[model samples]
Target: MATEEVNKPPSLPPYPEMIFAAIAGLNESNGSNKSAISKYIESSYGDLPAGHATLLAHHLNKLKESGELVMVKNNYMRPNPNSPPRRGRGRPPKPKIPLPAGAVVSPARPRGRPPKPKDPATVAAAAEVGPVPPRPRGRPPKMARPAGAGPVKTGSGRPRGRPPKNKTPFAVVGFD
Candidate 1:
């Protein structure tokens, strides 16, 4: 019978200097992500510990957080200390105005989409058209009550259960 081999972590000398060297290489070139930085480390230092890539990634993130580096567009780069931080996407929300303490807040506008602005043509044509009644919640009341639905035999519309037994007691004849 053939024996299966168990995988083990690669054994190498603990040299963290390699990580700093990789960072330097990254800075020299255009900014790169974690994987590229790891490859650079491996290429520079022949073989490393099994989790060296993860270790490098941790150091890179730490550097970024500590302000040694800046993460720009998903790549780590040298921080431009002279430049101000850029604002993020989207318009800022309107600031809330402070309401006077005893004033009752008027009822909120109805939920759901705001009414579309009325077009001049639509407004002019609207008098001839009947105003659309607000829709009801459920099944739309079966548009025109489906042609031939014989007076609904109602009762929760559930299937009937067991039929009732014979109402009168059976009379037994006595045998002498």
Candidate 2:
């Protein structure tokens, strides 16, 4: 017995055309993200009929390679122009330092000690002067308090707990 051969139509072209058509539709509807495109195809074509992920991925890669789509830093894919410039995959750029108008910068100063104020008398005496240096960038290192100062107490004035000897012991219910 001879078996009959069934002829099937070739699958649609999986190229830039279909991808661009989808992208054009997205642009027309102002929905330009990968997830949006995925959702559109899934909804329009009914869940992609399995194994379509590879095809979808291929088309998306082609679209990206052809500059029709770009992936944002956040992993969202949109039109190339809409995506922000990538600042490398490493650490973010250091924030720019801003300076006030007419401000002068000096060399880094020693960690401790405030600069002495300039005096007219010292100037008249022809005292040698040195350039004042820049203060340490952020806050000054906290100073260590004197040892005898004891634990600092809050303003509530509750004598920061009495000396350990003054603490009264309470009877334990189980022991009692």
Query: After superposing candidate 2, which stretches have Cα over 4 Å from the reference?
Result: 1-10, 28-31, 42-49, 73-176
Q: Over the stretch 130-167, how does candidate 1's per-residue lDDT look in tens digits? A: 68889887885545767688796869777799767888
Native-to-model Cα distance after best TM-score fit, residue 72 in candidate 1, in Å:
1.1
Q: What tens digits encode model 2's per-residue C-alpha lDDT throughout 119-141?
A: 88877666556555768788799
What would the TM-scores of all predictions be?
A: 0.35, 0.31
Which parts of model 1 are misplaced by more than 4 Å?
Answer: 1-20, 26-30, 84-176
Model 2 gets an lDDT of 0.62
For TM-score, the strongest prediction is 1
Candidate 1, residue 60: CA error in Å? 1.7
Q: How close is candidate 2 to the true structure, as a TM-score?
A: 0.31
